[model samples]
Target: MIRAARILFKATLWFVVLSVLWVGLYALVPPPFTLTMAGDLFQGRSITKDWTPLADIDPDMPRAAIAGEDARFCLHHGFDWRAIAGAAARNAQGRRIRGGSTISQQTAKNAFLWQGGGYLRKALEAWFTTLIELIWGKRRIMEVYLNLAETGIGTYGVEAGSIRYFDHSAARLTPTEAGRIAAVLPLPKKRAAIDPRGFVRRHGNAIAARVGVVRRQGLDACLK
Candidate 1:
């Protein structure tokens, strides 16, 4: 028992040290590929990803994502307590499991962790979210999220999504196109960004409207 405990302690210490160094390095350099992308590749799924700088991406794309995912993104640090409380209350009432994850949390998960949900993944996500919030800030967080998020089956990033769905570069995405992409973000594997139908179409319209609202109210001022 003593030997096992000692080994566990050493492993835990090493893990913490490596995690810190990894986060620090990513704060300065863009990650080569995310864990999710790697997992997909290992599963023999084709990946279509094009790394594009935030400046090269259309301004509407980030705005639409912020509108759809976390309207209070700029106001929060790493988590949104109001959204979390609302989701928890709804879940307790037996409603569908809705996630209240902010862009920072999503970025942390996409960049560092594999895709899944559980206490362990959530805990690690929270840790990485806090680290990115402190080190990467809002702009960097949004940039990484936009670039790493899976926008469709095998499609990664706004650039690749734009090209795949609209036959255009991300920098040229129109408001409606941006909204469609953002709408599919919640369930990219099931939703279609291009030629969206039913719920996706309505959701995209809602996101587009909110994009205007965020812009007018300067809800995304932190990125600027």
Candidate 2:
């Protein structure tokens, strides 16, 4: 028992050191690829992504993301307890599942962890989220998230999504265009950003409206 415990302690120490180094390295270098992208390849889908700097992506894109995903993005550290509480309450009531993950949390998951939910994954995600919040800060987190998030069936990044859906670069996304892309973000494989119907269309419109509000209220001030 003593030997096994010692071995476990050594293994955990090595994991902690390596994970910190990994997060620190990515602060300067864009991640090469993610597990989701590799999964697409394994399933015979071609990966499409363009790594645009946060400055090149239109302000509306991040604003739309903030509005549609996390309204208190600028205020949160790495997690939003209030949103998590709300989501948990709604989930307990048997509504459609809602995630309380902030952009920081989402970035950690997209960059380091795999898709889907499990206690183990969520615990690891929390660890990575803490590492990134300490090392990457808000702007870098948003930059990484926008570049790594899946925006379509095989598409990754807002830059690629912009070109795929709008035939234009993400550098000049209109509010509506940005909102549509943001709407597709949560369920990229299932939702179409262009000519979206039903919930997606309505949600995109709402997000578009909220983009201006996000800006006026300085909700995305960290990005600026």
Candidate 3:
């Protein structure tokens, strides 16, 4: 019994190590299918966290994103258990809004793992999420998210999305403008980043309200 337990522990350790290596390796090569979407790992570039620094962007941009996606970004170690629990409960009631994966998780999935929703995809994503959160921390994860979120069909990154939609850089995006951008992320084409319709406008306003709350409650409270 003791020998068997020791062997099982060793096997588990190897599996964990291999999984970490797999994610790290994938980060080196761009996604296999290679489409021209947000943060598609342009033809000639190496991976670097500094590729897009969080400080280079407008503060309101991240503020809106955290408000839209993961208000707990600053606080969580990678996973947002509350959001995950809420999503699961909603899914059980047949009212799932798709996903509750945090921004850090999305960065890991997009940068390393494959797309589509499934138990397997989600399991890998969760593991990779934790690994990257430990490896990259909050700021780098946010930087990657701003760069990789699919704002437009062919646009990638806040810089590209800003230019593609607004003909301006991300730094010029106002709070309302940033909210509009955040609104479209869940339904990229259906919601125009620059010219939101009534539905999109409603969503954008909701995100803006969250941002205001964050400002009042403080960034730390927003995470909570």
Candidate 4:
């Protein structure tokens, strides 16, 4: 039993060290690929992505993301307890399941982990989220999230999604365009940013409107 405990301790120590190094390296470098990207490739899907720096991408894009996804992105460290409580209460009502994960958490999951939910995954996500919040900061977190998030089926990143949907670069996305892209982010495989209908269209429009609010209220202050 003592030998087994010692082995486990060594393994955990190595894990912490390696994970720290990985996070540190990614702070200075864009992650080359993620597990989700590999999953798409294995399924015979053609991946489309372009890693545009946050400065090169339009400011509206992040604003739209913050408005539509996490309004408290700038205010929180890595988690928002109020959002979590709200999501939990809503979930208890038996509606569509919602997650209270902040943009930082999403970045950690996309950059270093896989999709889907499990207790183990959630715990790991929390760990990485803390590391990123401390090491990567908000600006880096937003940058990585925009670059790594799946914006459409077989498409990753705002730059690729922008070109595919609007035939233009992300650097010049209009508010409407950015909001539409952000709307499709939550369910990229099922939604279309261009010519969206029903909920997607409404959500996109709402997000577009909130883009102005995000800017006015400085909700995206962290990025600056």
Error of 4 at 5 (Å): 1.2
Relative to the true structure, candidate 2 has a C-alpha RMSD (angstroms) of 0.7
- Residues 1-224, model 1: lDDT tens digits: 99999999999899888888888898778888888888888889999988888889988899999999999999999999999999999999999999889999999999999888999999999999988898789999998899899999889999999999999899988889999999999999999897899999999999988888888999989988
Comparing 1 with 2 on lDDT, the higher-scoring candidate is 2
Locate the minimum summed-lDDT window of 10 residues in model 2: 96-105
CA lDDT, candidate 2, residue 76: 87
Stretches of candidate 1 off by over 4 Å are: 1-6
Where does model 4 exceed 4 Å of error?
Answer: none
lDDT of 1: 0.91
- Per-residue lDDT tens digits of candidate 4, residues 73-103? 9999999999999999999999999989999
Better of 1 and 4 by lDDT: 4
Better of 2 and 3 by TM-score: 2
Q: Give lDDT for model 2.
A: 0.95
Indicate whether candidate 2 or candidate 3 has the larger lDDT.
2
TM-scores of the candidates are 0.95, 0.99, 0.77, 0.99
Please report, as a residue range, the 10-residue window in candidate 3 with the lowest summed lDDT.
Answer: 30-39
User: Poorest 10 consecutive residues of model 1 by lDDT?
Assistant: 26-35
